[model samples]
Each structure stands twice: as C-alpha cells, then as structure tokens.
Target: MHKSIMIQGTMSNVGKSLLTAGLCRVFKQDGYKVAPFKSQNMALNSYITEEGLEMGRAQVMQAEACGIKPSVYMNPILLKPTTDVGSQVIVNGEVIGNMKAVEYFRYKKTLIPDIMKAYEKLTDEYDIVVLEGAGSPAEINLKQEDIVNMGLARMTKSPVLLVGDIDRGGVFAQLAGTLMLLTEEEKAIVKATVINKFRGDKEILKPGLTMLEDICSKPVAGVIPYVYLDIDDEDSLSERFVRRKEGGLVQIAVIRLPRISNFTDFNALESIEEVNLSYVTSPAQLQEADMVIIPGTKSTMSDLLWMRQNGLEAAIKKLADKGKIVMGICGGYQMLGDTLTDPYGVEASGSLAGMGLLPMDTVFEKEKVRTQVTGQVTSPVGHFKLLEGAAIEGYEIHMGTSSSKSGGISSFSRLEYGLAGKREVKQDGYIMDNILGTYVHGIFDSEEFLEGMVKTLLKSKGLNYEQVKTVDVKAHKEEQYDRLADTIRQNLDIEFIYKILEAGV
Candidate 1:
C-alpha cells in the first residue's frame, strides 16, 4: 500500500505548490519512489506530455522534483480559462468542451471516477504520493462538490497539512478560522498546520505558533522562511509578469496579453545572465527592446483585438518595418499573419485583420493540435541566418493552422515527428525579413537553439557573443530542486510528516 499526504493552502499562491514539490523531493532523496497528484487544476499555464497529452505545469514541476517523467495522470482535469466566466475543460489530456463557471461546478462532480482511476494508477506505481489542493477550502459555498480539497483527502484516506501564509499577515486567523469553518469530520483529516513564507525571526513568532496550535488543536509542523528559488509558477497570479530587471547586454520584451498561456516558455531565456526580459503591457516599454516576442494566448482573436485597441499592434508593425527582430509563438504566431478566419467560431465568429507582418493566413479549427516535435533550423536570411542548421525540439499546442498567403514562403524550421517506427517530416512557421513566427512553444529550451538566438541577437547589435556566458537551464533547475529540498529538510518536520503518513486519520 502507498502512503499519502496532502498540502492545502489557506488561500491561493500561499506556497502550497512549492511545499508539495519540496516534500516530493525529500521523499525521493530518502530512497522512496514518489509521484505528485492533483484532482483538478484551473490555470492558463499548461504543458504537453511526451504522449502529446496536456496537463498543468505545477504538477509537471513537482514531477520533475521527483525525478520522474510528467504524465497527464498527475493532473487529471485541467481548466484553461478563455474568458472571465467560461473555460476550456480538458479531461485526461483531451478537450471535452468549454463550460461556464456554474456549468462546470455542476458537471465536475461526475468526474470523480476519472480522478480515482488516475490516482489509483499512481498509487500502484509509487511508494508515496504527494497531493496538492487548489485555492482555499474555507469557501462554504464551494465545499459541496469539492473534489480537490477535504473531499479528496476523505476519498484518498490521506492526511492533510493546512498551510497559511505569514507573509500576508493574519496567519493565525487564516489557519484558525479555516478549521472553524470545516466540519468536525473534515477537521479530523488535518493532522498538522504549516506557516509558510515567513520572514525575520522564528523565535519572535513562537508564542503565536503555540497559541495557534492550542486554538486549532493540531500540531504546528513547520514555519518555513521565505526563500527565493527559480521554479515554475502556477498561473496568471505569478509575480514574474510584474517584475522588472535593469542592466543587461540584450533586452527582450514579451507582450503581456490578457489571456497569455504557457508564458513559462520564456523562462529559459530569462535564466541567461546577459539577457534582461520584461513583460510589456504597453508600447512605451517596447522602445528599447532589441527583440519583441508575442507570446501564446488562450483567445487569439480577442487578445489580438485588445492589442489593436491599445495600439500595440501598430507599434509592433512600426518596429518590424524599421528592421527590428519580431517573433511570435503559437497564438502570437497567428496574430502576425494577414488575416484570421474562424468559420467554426472556435475563437470568434468572423474574420479579423492581423498585424500583417508576415505573408500568411490563419484559420481556427475545432480540433486542437497537440504533439511533441524534434527538428533542425532550415535555411534562413538576414540576422536570423545564425540559427540555421541548429537542432531544436519542443511541443505544439494550438487550435489553428497557418499557411502562406501567396503560394509559399521559406519555412522557419523543418520538423520531424516520430510515430511507431517511421518518421514524418513537415515544415513549420514562416520567416520574412526581420519577422518570424512558429507554433512550437518551447523552441528555445534546447541549448543549441538558445545559444544560436543569443549569438544572433548579439551579432545584430555589433557585440561579441563570446563575452556572455550561456546558462545550462537543465542543470540549473536540478540545482534549484536540491536547494529547495535542503530548505524543506531544515525547516519542516520530516519525521512528523512520516508519522502523519503512517498514522493516517
């Protein structure tokens, strides 16, 4: 039998994901096979598995901490929000359909069987499973059909650790009030409480911790200090968008679309020491950028209209006309074309004018393209020629196909996909002058592609590329995982956690 423990937060972004990942790493280092599980996740940031199935990035990150391959079973149900009220609901890595907030709430209960099936598969394979809960469980209105929090703990027979954010203040009230709100049966499932994101002295907060334990009648397992580690974030609530870094050899600006999905694609580029990346919301921030990247979005047409209304479309066109490097990926790639037609109303009902930087047209389709690809850079012209012949690999997740408006143009890359024993080769994206676009999401993750891009940008600016050192993103992430595990081992009570897992509720 597999032992289980769950981490539930007092509110969203309270370090629940990080703590769960840390526990996963601790268990792995202790010579036990481990896996991460989440019943349902609602986030725009997603990842494509090796099987070409989609799942949330948080579980992906936790799976990495466990030194395991990411699987759709890690995140059984993923909800990618397309608007304020409606979301694209995906079950077991395939799109079921779009649903409104109320509609999904009524329909989510029916997915319990699917969730259990996935969970049982992981339990059968691993010695330990670290589960994560979304949002707060204190919302009385949402507690009825809650398959992700106390309800999941009940279903899985897992012990719970309630986490409260001390950095946001009211840690005691958050933990105490949450327990007060839960039913007696639900409260029994919680074995301990955790205070996360704490700064300053722990001795000063000892009195409050003791009082909190008394009030909640649960042991205080840990008070984790605020530590900075470069890890993937969950969703739009990520602080990476608002942060600004000064002084770098190269400046890259990414357009911050309202419905941006998979912005984590740029994380590898941001890890470079000589590259300063900023998420720009307006034209003013794009002035000094050496390259402007339009990122992926959930709603291509609506976000493109937003760019048009805010004058970013005109500003990007002006930059491209001036011979500045402009690149687009996925939905951003769709926006660089001449026109976008959605006869099936996948995004919107009519045709919309694009930025017209590249000579291509896009048409949204009902079926989404999801796959993992490997390829090499094809023939190129101008400054981008530096990337020619470079090996590249990434995954594709989009709802439309783009093609040349006038016959055909030079492709940005030649892609190959493996199926059974045969290999299928196809061309992807288009390149024109200083503008290029591709549907590949993690195009820069490969060292050859990233180094080539940096060298190209540097050569364009009349600088020596050898002056800047390239980062090995894979090794850097491994170091970060170890650092996170070290912190958790030092601050949290691992022995107590083991006891909780063994004792259960």
Candidate 2:
C-alpha cells in the first residue's frame, strides 16, 4: 500500500524541488518508507550514481533527503541543455544524443512506459513515493504532449498539490491562472494548493487564501513560512549561497562567476561559526577577504572570459601576487593554470589563457573522467599534511586531464573506481604552496582538510582560530531532512494528503 503525492509548481523556481524533499522527509519521519521521483529533469548540474549512471542533481538532492543513495531510476530522463534550442538527452543515465525541444516533446511520450516501470519498482519497495514535477503544468502550449506534470499525474492517477511562491508576488494570480488553464480532468487531480516562501505575517494572507479556494474550489493546505535552513539547492537559483550572513571572524571571498558550478562545495564552510563567506563579484569586493576561492564552472573558457570582462582576472593576479591563499576545484582548478588547450573544441570557442596562478595546463578530451575515489594528500602544504593518510572520498566528473612540471606534486593519488592506474605527472598539472587545484568535487567534505584549510587561512592573517567540527556528514544531512519534514507536517493538511494517497486519485 504505497501512497504517493505529486508536488507541482505554478512555475519554475516556485520551490517544487524543496517542497518535494520536505514531503519525503515528513513521510519518512511518520514511519513510512519514502522515496522521491521525477519523470524528467533538465539541468547541467548532474551526479553519477553508484551504478555509473547519470541523473539530475535535483533528484540527487531529494534522494539525499531520503537518506538513500541516488539511483538512475529516481530520475529516468535527464536533459542537459547544450544550446538555446537543443539539449543532450540522457535516458536512464546514458546519453542517447542531442534533441531539439520539439523533438524531445514528441519523443518523451514514448518513454512513459519506462517511467511507469521505474515508478512501480519504487512503489513496491517503499511505503510512500513523493513525485516532483518540473516547471509548470499550465504551459498550455506544451500541454498536449506533456509528460512531466499533468500528464504524469494522469498516468499514475496521483493527487496533485500545486505550490506557488508568494514571496515573488502575484502568487494568487499564478495559482488562479494555472488552475483556470487546466483541463477538467487535470484540474480534478489537484487536491490542494499550498503557498510557499511566505514572509511576514500569515494572517495577512487569509483573504487571498479564501479567494483562491473560492475561485478554484481547492482547499488551502498551508502557507509555508520562509525557513533559512542551511541546505543545498539543486538548480542555478540557489538562495543558500546568496543568503549567507556576515561573520566577524575569518573572511573568505568566493568569486561568483557567471556560470559557476559545484558552488555547493562551500556549504560546509558556511556552517562554521568563525568563517565569513561572501561571493565576490567585483575587484573591489576581492580586497576585503583573507582568502579567495574559485568554484567549478560548466564552460571554463566562457567563464574565464567573463572573469576578464569583470576585471576579476586582474584582481586574482593581484591577490596571488600579494601572497594571499587561493584555491580552485574542478573547472576552477583548470582555470588556475597557465593555459587550457581545448583543441577538440570540448568546452566552447577553443583554447584560452588561464589565471596563471599555477604552472600547469589542461587539455580537454573527448571522453569524460567519471569516478569516486578515496585517498590521502601527499603534498607539503599544511592543508595537505592535515589530510595526509586521512581517508578522503569524492567523485570526479570532468572531460579533461591536467599536467604540471612542478616537482613534489601528485598527478593523481588514491586511484579507485573509474581510475585504472596512477595518473602520470607531466611538466604542467597540480601545483602546491599557496595554491591547490584538483578535478575532485566535494573535496571540502573531508573534515580534516576543510577545517585545516580554514584554520591555516585564519592563522596566515595572524588571527586567533576556533576549531569547528561537523559530526557525521550523513547524519547531519538526515537531521536536516527530519527538520524539513517537520516543517511540512506542521503546515500542510496531513489528513487530506493521506486520503489522496490511500484513494490513489
């Protein structure tokens, strides 16, 4: 008796993904085995599952909320947008080829059986399945062939809970307009409407809520207040990165590029009480920080160009010249080198000059290097020493290999799955002393390495340090899931949701 509910947004960035995760956590706390499902997701941010399959980072985050390893079945179809009108279609974690918007719309309907199969598999194993819908079901132009929203609801006969963002304003119209456009059958499946991201007093929304229920004949489930939980957002509209408070202790500036990826790497740092984290957008902003970090990027060349355009290139050069500590991860690591040669046109507009902080070069290859590795740091840097022989684990998802001539630098350490052998060190790759660049994402998850870096940076500034340690990363995340679940449970209509799941409407 697996009960399910689908949370669909009135529009994109309406907090559907977060809501889905919250519901999954809530149901799980209520003694129900719960999982999250999405029929299709489109984003460049992706994760490689344990089975070596790829899926959207949204479902990956949702899966994290459920305290489970991510699976390709959780997100059966993923579209990584490569161009304005086309995307690289990944079906069941394998690339099928690039397809235009119109082509994908027509092709998506054919995959319904596969989606249903995955859904059925989850239903059999879990007591509850919370499905998240992408974008909106009110796109009348695209409704005829929709498979992500109303169409998926019809397919599973699942009750729908439409969520609207009140913080963005005109939420009433957003919900009212969407309901007005829904087909009779589509409208019938919607059991309740929940207003999300509401700030200020909930009493002020009473009239608006009454009007919405009167017009749509749907009950107002709850008005979710804005909760500033320190969690990762799956998409580009990540408020977690931007909503950070200023700390009076160690100041670290993160260069906010136009196409920043893997920005979630800084979440652990944000949790530290003694660290002040800010996203530096201008050269003037860079001058106030003790250390600077360049995060990963989707298009290294394009982001590099953007850096130059914003005068950040000059700022980075000045910071390095002043002997300030700087670090780069993945594409950010690629950008810290002398030159990046993309002779194969792998990352847009050919080769380009790097920030030149390290004497290394990166060459983009046709194939991507994807793997999960656990190892120790062998470099002379104190941060590396702290991480020496310390069990470290993270995944690598990139399309290039780095080479450096600097002695005492490990080309690749701790080879694990997807890494067949030791990586060769050339005249150019990973360099040490005042700089560290690696293709590994999630490196900050290593407690010894992260805390040490923060302490070292603080000590470099002649400032007193405080040791802040995170207990069990996995447990901390599960606790977050429980908190999110509690929030939804306290606000939403639990009886109605249970009835919908029981009735299979």
Candidate 3:
C-alpha cells in the first residue's frame, strides 16, 4: 500500500515547501521509495522538465531531495502568475491559457479528475507520496472548488499535518483560529499540528503549545527551527535581495533585469564562502564588481531594450573591453551574440542588434529546444584548456538557435540536429576566452565548470589560484533533510499521526 502525508500551512510562506522536501527525504532515508506532489502551485519561478513541460521549481527541489529525476507528474497543475490577479494555467504539463481569479475558481472543479489521475499515477509508482498544499486551507471563500488543500486531502484520504508559522507571531491565534474555521470533515483529517520557523528555545512556548492543543483538540506534532538551507525557493516570497556576506572576496555582479528568468543559476555561487554575489539593477552598480553576469530572461528582446534604456548596454561593453569575465546563460547567451533576429516575432517585436561580444547570431525559432544534455568542453582558454574532458550535464530550454562564422565548438547535439545532417556546433553554441554563452540551464551545477570559471577569473586578476572544493550539494541536502526529519520525529506525536494515517478518511 502507498502511504502518504499531506503538509498544509495555516498561511502562505509558512515553510510548506521545505517541510514537504524534508518529509520526502525522511521517507526516502527510511528505505521507502518516495515522491513529492502538489496539486496546484502558483509561482513565477518554473523549471522545464526533461519532457519539455514547465513545473514549479519547488517540486523539482523536493524531487532532488528524494534523489530522483523531476517529472511533470510531481506538479500536475502549475499557475504561472502573469499579474496580481491573473495567471497562465498549465494542466497536465500543457498550457490551457490564462485566466482571471474568478474564472479559475469557477473552472477549477472540472480539473478534479485530472488531479486524481496524476495522483494515482504517482502513488502506483512510489511507496509513499508527500503532498504539499498551497496557501491556507481555512480560506472558506475558496473551499467550494478547492483542489489544493483540504479538498485534495479528502480526495486522497491522506492524513493532514497543519503547520503554522510561529516566527510570524500570533502562533496561538493562527492555529486556534484556523482550526475553528475548518469544516468538521476537513478538521478531522488534520491529525497533528506543527509550529514551524521557531527561533528561540522550545521550552518557553510549552504553555502556549499546550493551550493551542487544548483549544484545537489536536496533537502538537513539532516545533521546527528556522533553517536557512541553500536550496532554490520557487515563489516570489522567498525571492528577495540576498545580502552579500561581509568579507574581502571575489565580487560577481548579476544584472537583476526586470524579467530575469533563471536566477536560480547563481544559488550555488551564493553558497560559496569565497565568492560574493550581488544582483545589480543599475549601470552604476556594475562598476564595483570583478565579474558581470547577464542572467537568463524570458523576454530577451524586451530585456535588451531595458538594458539599452538604463544605459547598461554601454556599461557591459566597457566591462568586456576591460578584460572582465562576462558570462550569459540561455536567453542571456542569445543576447551576447552579434544580432538577435526575430523576423517571425516569436519572442517580441522585430530584429535587434545584440551586444556583439562574440562572432555569432541568434534566430528565434517557432519550435523550442528542450533537452537534458551531457558533454565536455573542448575549447582552449590560456594554458588550462578548461573543461577539456570534464563531464557536464544540464538541461536546455530555449527558442533561439545560435551560429558562428568560424565554426562553433562541439557541445552536444539533439537527435533532430544529428539526423538532419547538421552538427551540434552549427546549431548555435559558442565559447571564447573569458566569455562563454550557452542555452543550457543548470550548467553551473557542474563542479568542473564552476572551477574552470573560477580559475579563469583568478587568471584575469593575475593571481595564483587553486581550485577550492565545497560540499557535495546532493549529499548536503539529504543530510539537511535528515536533520529535519529527526527533529520532527523527536517532537511530533508520531503514534497519533500513525493512527490517523492508518484510518482512512
């Protein structure tokens, strides 16, 4: 039998995603095959799966914790918010079109079967499935057609663990009031209550915890401490200005464009103790950094225009000419070429001049290139010839293809590119000294690639360098989750939770 647990928050940003990931890791470590599930998630931060479908990055992070490849099934319903009140709804990995709040609420009930289908598929494959609920379940106004919170719990007949943010204050009111508002059926599904993001000593809150349990008639599961794990957050709430640690170190500036798409590319760098990462919006801020990185953008042409409007275009040129290392990924890679031609107006407007740093041009194609690639770099960079035979693996999701005049370096080829009598190099990928651009996402995860870039930066500074290795990220994440699970196990009413799990709703 596939046992599952649902983690629901009393409010948004109450550590629902992190708790789900922790549970996934915990179950996996307990010798159970586990999978993460979210019926619906609304976030601008998305990740392209190997199947070329877009899903919330939170599920991808949770899947990583379980040591599994992320799949579209993990997040069956993704709502990419286009505005404050509207979102582009994706159903079963395909876009169904944009809808306003009311329209989605009225239409969401029709998707229950779809949600069930996806959930069943996951349960059939895994020994345990950890379901994550979005926002608060006590929002009675949305309960009519809700499929993400208590409604989903009712559908799966899974035991629910209500989590409240003690760090946000009003822990007692948030827990007590939420329980008072829940329907009796919905309330019964909640087997245990969790107090998350507690900062100080747990003993001090004993009376409060007892009072909360007495009022709600539910067992207090755990009071989890606030953990700052270096994982990718998939919502706007967690996406904020991360302060640069105070230290004299190598400074790298990333242009925080208005439409920056893949900012998660820099998460690994942020964790490096010797590197300082800053997101700059103005051209003046670019002068204080040792290296400038133009991150990926969803709308390349518009962001290029944004750069030109803000005078950052000239600033980047000056930085490049001064022998500063400049890197771009995906859409940012497309912007580094000679010109960007969108004659078909696929992305936006018309053709425009690119930064012209490399002898290359990018053309927007109707068909997007999305794939998981594995290869090694074969380019000459001073005496090191960085990444000559180093194995690198990452995914590519873009609609533009690049080409160079003197022939491009071999990276990896798609089956279509190969069978069409075309080489991967000709499909628009380029690399040169101190400048590298590619359409592949998540390439920085490769230690070989990061070390190579670090070496190049050190060389540019005329300083001797030795590659400094950090912790293995995958192992580190698993260990973090293990710690979280241990904490939960020690504090929660495990017997009561197990009894609820055993008794189906």
Predicted model with the maximum TM-score = 1
Q: Could you tell which candidate, 2 or 3, scores higher by lDDT?
A: 2
1 or 3: which has the higher TM-score?
Answer: 1
lDDT of each: 0.91, 0.79, 0.78
CA error at residue 140 for candidate 1, angstroms: 0.6
Per-residue C-alpha lDDT of model 3 across residues 248-269, encoded as one tens digit per residue: 3678998887667767777777
Model 1 stretches astray by more than 4 angstroms: 418-422
Task: Compose the digit string of candidate 2's lDDT tens values, residues 278-374.
Answer: 8878999887777788888767888888889989989887877787878888888889988898977776746788888888888898777666655
Q: lDDT order of candidates, best first?
A: 1, 2, 3
Candidate order by decreasing TM-score:
1, 2, 3
lDDT of 1 by residue, 227-261 (tens): 98988888888888987777678899999999999
How many clashing pairs per prediction, in order?
Answer: 0, 7, 2
TM-score of each predicted structure versus truth: 0.98, 0.92, 0.88
Pull out the clashing pairs in model 1. none
In terms of lDDT, model 1 sits at: 0.91
